[model samples]
Target: MTERKVIWNGRVQSDMVDYNGHMNDASYSLVFSESLDALMETTGLDASGRERHAYTIFTLEAHIRYLQEAHEQQALRTTVTILDQDAKRMHLWFEMENEDGDTIATSEQMVMGMSTTTGRPGPFPEEVEQSLSPLPKLDREHWPTHANVQMGIRRK
Candidate 1:
């Protein structure tokens, strides 16, 4: 398995907290999403590039595990791992952690390439594929091996 790849880092805003006084579940999704946005840039799948090819990625499924809570103003970071990929889709794992290196949450996602103009599923362009080739191979072991991860959103 490959080591964690830090994609984005930031602070937890007080506004992101819920009534329970910690970062809300939706915020975790946002963090994971923003991190994925960063990775997309690195992988040659960003907005301009996708638009140029008339294709983009759509999330097919997502699974998250809340291990620990994050509070307001806490410095945190997200690490992403490309678990698997093919011409049409990519599977990824992400971890949200506090500055002290504790995992606050984990998310796994399956995203598919789709034609922007026609909105039909399609494979990535060769240029995009070539750009993503240099990234490390996906390894499931990099994520928690035994946890029961499933597709379903959870409310904090």
Candidate 2:
């Protein structure tokens, strides 16, 4: 398995804290969303690339699990793993860790390439696909246990 690369880094701001005195539920999603942008930039989907190819990536779905609390001023880092991808869509897993290296949250997302002109799903441009080739790709068997979870009320 290739080592996952840190894609984004940030510190929890005072505004991100809730009455509980830690990052709020929505804040976790916000950080993960920012991490996605960083991933897009690395894959040649940045503003100029999107304009040049008339293409962009859109988040189709996202599931985030909060494992620990993040406090204000705590340093945070995020890494992404490409679980799978096709011509038009990608299954990605993002992990956010606190300064102590404890995973505070994880987000599994499905994103797709879209044609900005037509506002429809489309295959990624060749250059963008090529750029994504170097990123970490992990097989299903190697995925973390928390990944691919189905959310619902459980009863036995």
Per-model TM-score, in order, reads 0.86, 0.96
Steric clash pairs (candidate 2): none
Candidate 1 residue-wise lDDT, 1-156, digit = tens: 346788899998988999999999999999998987888787777878887899888889888889998999999998877778888898887888899998888888888989989889999888888877766564555545733355467879
Error of 1 at 127 (Å): 2.2
The number of clashing residue pairs in each candidate reads 0, 0
Best by lDDT: 2
Residue 18 miss distance in model 2 (angstroms): 0.7
> lDDT scores for all predictions?
0.83, 0.92
RMSD of 1: 3.9
* TM-score of candidate 2 versus the correct structure, residues matched by position: 0.96
